[model samples]
Target chain A: MLTFKVKRRIIYLGIFCFTLFLCFFYVIKTLNQSLLYFKTPSEIFDDQNLDLSKEIRLGGMVKKNSIKVNKREIQFIITDLKKEILVSYKGTVPNLFLEEKGVIAEGKLKDKKFFIANRVLAKHDENYKPPSENQLDKK
Target chain B: MMRNLFSLNKIYIFSEKTLTFIKSVFPVLLILGLTFALVLSPPDYLQGDVVRIMYVHVPSAWIALGTFSTLTVLSIINFIFKIKILEIVNLCIAPIGLLFTCLAIITGSIWAEPTWGTWWAWDARLTSMIVLMFFYVMIIYSQKHIKPKNRSLMFTSIISIIGAINIPIIKYSVEWWNTLHQPASIKITGETSIHSSMLMPLMLMLLILLLYSALIFLMKYKTEIIKVKRSGVKRL
Candidate 1:
């Protein structure tokens, strides 16, 4: 009887997990096809698991003086301190999108490091501040 | 032995016990759930009919938090009162809360992207729900790392209580802060924030969800009882 009960619990747990697993993937993959997974430049070049065909987002702070625009196409560089990615966009840009600010560019890669953006999202949560030195000293 | 004393109830005193209770309750819940499903529940006036999803959303949210709260208190009871039943109750509620939390997040997410223009926002409710989900998964996963004895319950209860402080924050955050999430459409004021026509199906669906939640709650609790009984027998 104990064996039967343990077996039942294990089976139920397995069933619940399997269902959630399926639902999670169904939602993610559907979102993946429609939208894009935001990834950093270093995450891509460092050889992470990412779908190449589907859309993706390249996010980082815009490197200083790395912006170039010619008619419909705009090119810029995104830096994550150690490395950077050349990003180009072919559509309307977000209002707050510009140099030295954190930007998330949605598209796919073209060359080894070049990103073609279809949509862009500007960073909104910018009130980040470190606790004062006095607070740290108290701790 | 404790089961015998409670068996002599007022109304349903059939000796053919376990099967009898299951048979009776099962159809009632099924009928209640089925009737609401049939009504097709008229659309909410403001949200239109899409708000019928609230039927599922609210109960899941309710049960999700309710189950977690139950778990926390039972865990505390197990520690303080040293009640063995409370410990089992705490264990049983953990995964049940996780299940409802999963349901709540998914239903909320599906409803969110359509109306809110995005699947998720960093509003207090959504943020806390994400953190709750993370904590749920972490607690469940960390169960393996913990000793099988009651030592894990102490730490788990602490985590549960700490996470619970956020529930009130989530409830009031919409009022306190600027948020994309709309405030509660239904309220205690009785001014009928939603149209009367929509209220019927909405209430119906709410009933269905409550019944469904109770049904699942009983099912999970029953199975948990069996497990505890089995484990006790093993130790014997």
Candidate 2:
């Protein structure tokens, strides 16, 4: 048998943990929808009731050989491998914006197929490696 | 028996000895860490030398997260047991965690600009980190400004326990959301994506920061002990 004080402490701990669990449950229930920072092309296509007027973020890889550059605007296809959306932007892109690389475009949708982006950000993978000899020579 | 083993007098004496040892070792390790991070580590194939920021950025983030987790655990224990030493430990740790959290945010902004083309974003990971900083500020503010010592302790402990909810949210934010921040490269289990060459300097920097935190914690703990004694606290 445990002492009374130890038993009381255990009761306190149990109460504390249960309160924490309740808080976690409440946050998950209420904040789940707002917590998604961006939506992918596939998600946009799958959802028909998404608001079109509000500014939203579209994130995916820049599809290979889908880039079209003009003097003032640039256009490219953003894809999640299952679906694709055309993104048009007038602002300058980040240094990491390249074909077959991850990119996030922030703007509103023109339709189900095209997005008008006011900002573009490049997303790189976690892997870090030094430039190979030929790539270094190109620089 | 447990109380006697962790009595304030014993902790004070232990801190004095440890502080001297830490003071001697910190500068040497800091120099070695800087050399390895700046000169020895290879530049990234894509970002080049800008990748060096990870040495400072990643460790600060890790320390900030680790300190908050520790504070939350200790706060919970102190709340249940009313341990005086644990109170002092929490007091010393909150400020250090705040400093590192700020450092991580600033360094992350600097890293974000060149690579991501933006200095800030409302992404889940970044937003969650900002929320953590606010929680730290709230805890520190309550500790400093609240009246009636017992009431202050209760408030701080409650805030810390509530703030503990954000810790898991911050860690898993990148994975759970479509955020600009990439997922973790280093894992406790399974294979790590980061190369060994860069990993060495990162580990060294982590060691240096850990030592620095230890040094600060010991000093703060010693001062708190002295303050308690001067106030004629006979419980010790």
Candidate 3:
């Protein structure tokens, strides 16, 4: 007959191994999904086979003077140093969303050159402040 | 052996001291941290008043991560050395750590809506933190189910060791992956990317939260000890 302690030890080991397996499986799945969810303008440009209909995130810096605010929609260009893709977003934009800053737009691409963003997110660097007020005025 | 590790009389004195500390120091620090965080801090040039959320959000995140790391180390020590006091310390910290983890997620979500334009995303950093919370829940649950003193400790220790692997993943997730969450501003290299103005309130809040967690853990630890003693048991 198996001792009580041995049986308990066996149960503990089983639970530990099971949980560890599940944790790793979940981690791997998340890592794979992240790669698919995140893409730069250049990556989308390079990947011709990427689905245009599905919603995706395109991250890049907003090009200077690319913003055009109209009555219904706001349009801009997202550039990843090497390539640029035009994006048009409707509804209110984030407060921090500005020109010459990093941004991520989530939407569907109409074609290789144009992206229709449903939601636009402004990305800022780690720096808390944008230099002094007068310094910005000097610029 | 457990009796020697946590004598009843010593626990009485320690709990009394902890209560006094909580009553005296905790309130002062809480008020100061809140004043600096909510009122004194300047609004962000870009985020404006929404930056106030960072005062709570950042500290909660730091404590959540810090508590988990502390729990993992204590678990390893308890497992290898078979120390009962270490196990009690480990158990006492889990609930507090879980609370901070939940706070971090809630605050982050609130901050995200206005800042990131989304309440939640399955990005690398956010998902990893959710996973860490799940791990904490599982560890807390297993403590109740596993029978036998040593067996429970072994299981909890193993679970914690496994979960510790996620801590590093959470820290580096923003850097390693392109996620909605931003990279860390305060690094250990003493080279902060944020301005001194914002960093001051943030640091004060962080220190206050750390102190608050210590106060909470001390109270919980004393309660655990009293409960164990009342039950006339040497091990929990």
Top candidate (lDDT): 2
* Pairs in steric clash, model 3: none
Writing each residue's lDDT as its tens digit, candidate 1 over B61-90 gives: 777777767766665444444555565556
Error of 2 at A89 (Å): 0.9
TM-score of chain A of each: 0.61, 0.89, 0.72
True contacts kept of each: 0.00, 0.76, 0.46
Candidate 3 similarity to native, TM-score: 0.86
Local accuracy of candidate 2 as per-residue lDDT tens digits, A1-139: 7668877987986798788889787977798878777788989998979788999999999999999999989999999999999999997899999998899999999888999999999998888766674276689
- Clash number for each model: 2, 0, 0
Q: Candidate 2: where are CA atoms >4 Å away?
A: A133-139, B233-236
Residue-level lDDT for B73 in candidate 2: 93
Residue B154 in model 1: lDDT: 58
> DockQ winner among the candidates?
2
In model 1, the Cα lDDT at residue A135 comes to 51
Question: What is the lDDT for B222 in model 3?
Answer: 81
Please report the TM-score between candidate 1 and the true structure: 0.54
Candidate 2 lDDT score at position A17: 78
Instruction: Provide the TM-score of chain B versus the true chain B for each model in turn.
Output: 0.77, 0.97, 0.91
Those runs of model 3 whose alpha carbons end farther than 4 Å from true positions after fitting are A1-33, A130-139, B1-12, B233-236
lDDT of all predictions? 0.61, 0.90, 0.82
